[model samples]
Target: MTNLAKRIIEFVQRPGYMPMKPKTLAKKLGITKKKLAKFEAALEEAKLSGEIRFSEGGRIQPKAARGSHLGIVHRIKSGDAFIILREPKPVGLTDDIFVDRNDLKDAQNGDEVFVKLLQRRRSRGQRCGYVVEVVERATNVFVGTYLEEDESGWVQIDGKDYPDPIWVGDPGAKGVQEGDKVVIEMLRFPTVGQNGEGVLTKVLGSRGEPGVDTQMIIHEFGIPDEFPDDVLNEARLEAENFNENDLTDREDLSEMTVVTIDPKTARDFDDAISLKKIEKGHWLLGVHIADVSHFVQPGTQLDREAETRGTSVYLPTKVIPMLPEIISNGLASLQEGRTRFTMSAFIEFSAEGIPIETRFSRSAIKVTQRFAYEEVMPIIKAKPSEPIEGVSDEIRELLKNMHELAMLLRKRRFAKGSLELDMPEVRLSLDTDGKVTGAFEAEHDESHEIIEEFMLAANIAVAVRLNDEGIGFLRRAHADPAEAKLKAFSEFVTILGFELEKYQSKKHLQALLRSVRGTPQEQAVNYAMLRSLKQAEYSPMEVGHYALAEDQYCHFTSPIRRYPDLHIHRLVSSLVCDNVTYRGASAEDLIRLGHHCSTTERRAERAERELTKIKLLTYFEERVGEKITAVITGVERFGFFCRGVEIPAEGLVHISNIPASESYEFDRQAMALVGRRTGDMIRLGDKVIVEIASVDVDRRELNFKLLTHTASKPPAKKGAAKKSPSRGKKGSKKPNSKQSKPRKKKPSTRKKKSAQKRRKKR
Candidate 1:
């Protein structure tokens, strides 16, 4: 055979081929045998890398179960790495391991990795191991600062072990300069210390720009920037009617005095309440919640998305709604003068704080007025304005009576060990352009407390029915306090000459709150106590809310924003539709539901906190070098954190900022940053002056310089005559007016020793 034909014959001899025939080569490439011969040698000379060589038949194979372990990476901190896994363990047959640096493959912090565990070790009584594989990347979106080196630019992702520097090589690559806040899309993973190429997905304006920080936060968290078009269309279509056919089956309460009390800017009035006297010693209170469940059926496109989101995310500048705005702020909102579908709970109570009776129903209610918390607070305080067009005299009277009943209920709740947690929220004041101009603490007054009490009562009533009927329902449940934290908190308070009341029950916690009510450290102690309690979550358990001291607590109101509330509404409505009583829900379902809600809640909180931190950094940038009085809220070995009293900004005082002459250390048990040399300390409530030194908006960090308040030195003692000193010579000069005598340098040690010997001879 000729050289070309011989090459073709060799290609056909490969193991992947069944025949060594030249005709088979021509058929595979759809070319003549003569054409295939030209490139035959190159095709037969293919090569594979060491890692790729482990595949089968030139195709990569997934690791088998017997030897493989898979888990989602939570984080890769300095000391060790951690991943949350479901079951399998490689460190041992049963022990789930925590991976170390060498074992970790090219895994980003939050990626899903197939780790080969090296060994399991106990550190502080915890199981940890060394990871060996990074099977996949979780997200391509990276929050980072564009960095410049030599003549090229890249993005340094603000995450752990992210050795890959995303290279900016494209035309728009030079748009974002060094130290600029930007988002980078990871195109490919580069080897350690090499530049990984990326496209600049977004350039959040220059750092420290107001509103840019919050916008960056929204992008960094992977939160939706805009609503999907399809969801908006569905919301519009679903909102087309308020037909009589729908209202026929619902109770009509349009004649009642139903008004919503919320913050002035509230667009979604999901809940409203009304009150009336049933008898000389009895009263009827109605809590009406917008029946969002009726319109958005379960398993529908809108419902599915809402379930995935779980709840609406409220940020300082914008809202990430659970549903489209059309429904959340329109149809589902109980707007005044518009009749809307509602889930009503009629709770009757006696003078002695006992519920005489309760009834739940679907209703058609027309809200008479929308009263802001600020507006109704005065009326509740018995200071009423002239009845306006919407608010009649009778409605004003009804509000007054409701406030009284609510006060009784509130007192009773506190008696039952309802925590008086001092949770003061920071309200951001923004300009028309959505820039955070300033931040102020919001106070909780009677009007706020009154609305809270009735809502709590309504939620409890719904929970009672669901529990009694034994149906699958969503209930917000809180677990008991962690014993260790409680013990620590108790020990902390004892140092201040106080003792925590025996927490035999929620009632005991109530007593503790009451005892600390008028003290200076009340709010601090309250915050600590609140932190000790478990977060309330959606569950199937019949157990009551321990913190609220209520056994019938359920999230039945606010269906417009909360998914669990919608689920509860559906369960109750389903029970009514099926002509059945309540049915107890499965514990397993409850656990699963609770887990989702808890996780989502934490995510929302973290996102909110991140946004706040960013905004705070921006807020501080404008006020750098300005002085502000603050309270030390937290302390660490690296720094002490303090929050401004007037502004909502909090910043850290790095250890370097502390004067070298003074000694400082963090006191863990006392929760104080104490100065050992001066015996001056900063604790949870200690007041101190701090100057805003610098801000890193991208990192959402603020640095403060502590201004030492040194006590004024006593006036210099009298009869201390200043002496003359030598000028360009070793010996001292005599004092004379014309001589321009220099002041004596405070005697050097050698001069002092000679002078002392002369004085002794004298």
Candidate 2:
């Protein structure tokens, strides 16, 4: 064996060595740039010789013995866990093993562990196993609420992973008060028998204060909200050095009639569009994207920070920008009437919206107009003769052409089996105090479609160009859904009175979606289909985007906010401009980068959703006992879950709240609950009135009581009931026991009975 292979094996066999990816292993070994290639070669040779193995996540580890597997633990609230196998599975084993809570040992959520299969199959046909060893811990720090007792303090970690609070010993430690949000560093994890121990590292603030919840979310998700001094200084330097007139080696489209369309609350505009009708029923379209690569050079602090952020996070109250505001909002922002550097895609299209030719250029542009989505449709629908004030003829004609072409492209896209799962975003209206005053679903209209189609076109064009040139770049990939999942979705929709003829066909899925449009079942059906499909993520593989029906697709616009786009801009600029050099990334490097970016993106999304839920829960605290109409989104044996039509807040209606006169049984096949005595049914998509029972903000739980009379048939009348205790044996008459006794009740008993009757009536 080579000396390098020997060194790798020695390092991996160390007592406390954990599995690591090739890049991380190289860094640990202090491999120089000159030896990277030789090191990688030796590592591959080691794997080939059975001295090492690669996990499913591409982490290097020593080959495992039979019956033992390396995997990551995913624990649910019930304490039961599933081990996602990282190594090759043994014969007849499933992809994951189910470990009972008692068999989990010391394994926690997200921990890498070694499992020993029990050689037993679960009732559901899954393999069962037990965790034997924890190989690595995902994290040791956590955010939680600090609770103060008489002389001791405890930290209740957020989420369901740590069900019980960890003991922190002293209440005065870190000056933490009762109910203060704080960060905890775990000294030991909790087990079934003993409480976990931790130390208070930092105190965030008291609960329910302004901006405190946001901070909690930020810390909980480990999101980077603040820029480092070096990063900020680099951004400032770039801003100071930027000169709009320095258009060396760049195409000047400053005179073009380009316009930007975005939300009215938008602070930075990264994309602008222009279109012109050409001879012989052809068209020239220009998609100008802010040239973020021009300022964020490779191996610079700004580039490092942007790459680490991956994408800008859009919280309801604030934004954690990928790049500092100086560059993201100032230098790279394509503001109206301002000259900006951009990477432009010029495409020539036939009248049928088929691309005839495509080219890229580093260019300079001056945006002629900026229109919010709410404003564009009004102008487009206006009569040409009745031109509104400040609406120039050139800008009006450009918008008209844009809408025309976008429709053609959109129609063609759907015809090719693209799925349209564009659910309306529930936008909250907040006051200056960051409290939600109200919320409404944002409309997705033609104005939004115009920009979407253009951006998609540019992305596909760039991806194809890069692929044709044999370059490695990240693609926005969405894998096809598993057949089993699609079949389940088919059964689900069929139970809702919708038919999906062929579950495996995309066209059939599209048809199913179309049939439910504009109906009360639209939201439920869309959400189910979304859950059925895999999430779209960044990868260098040619997996293709399933939803867009595009085989070659990448994110190329909005470089100012998305790192992948900036990377694409750099590659494309190198091809078009003579002054730039392409710093090629290997396929392995792209894969790692893609995984990191995808993780960061998911983290951002989860943080936003979590914070939004907190805000919504806070809003609903003032709304307890209020009645609102809701649609049942999920049904179970324990009752159904529903979301309010107006507020969009979800809460559970426990089966215990059902009328006592009738018993309800869960119908799993039908996705509903049925009252055995009254024959009333409650199923998905059923609209019903519900009253908010309570709100628990700390736990992030909401409860509702189903108004039985409004949701189903009223309880049978007391005297008219078919089944009663007064009925005796066949043909034998018996006096009613209650009437014969004639017993008097206490005043409190009478009032309690009266209250129960009133509750049943509602």
What digit string (tens of lDDT, one per residue) describes model 1 on residues 573-616?
Answer: 76656644224345544555566666566667888887776666
Q: What are the per-model numbers of colliding residue pairs?
A: 14, 0
Candidate 2 regions off by >4 Å?
1-5, 18-66, 86-91, 578-580, 709-762
How much does candidate 2 score in TM-score? 0.89
Task: For residue 505, give model 2's deviation from the true position in Å.
Answer: 2.1
lDDT of each: 0.68, 0.84
TM-score of every candidate: 0.76, 0.89
Model 1 residue 509 CA deviation (Å) reads: 3.1
Q: Model 1, residue 180: what's the lDDT?
A: 80
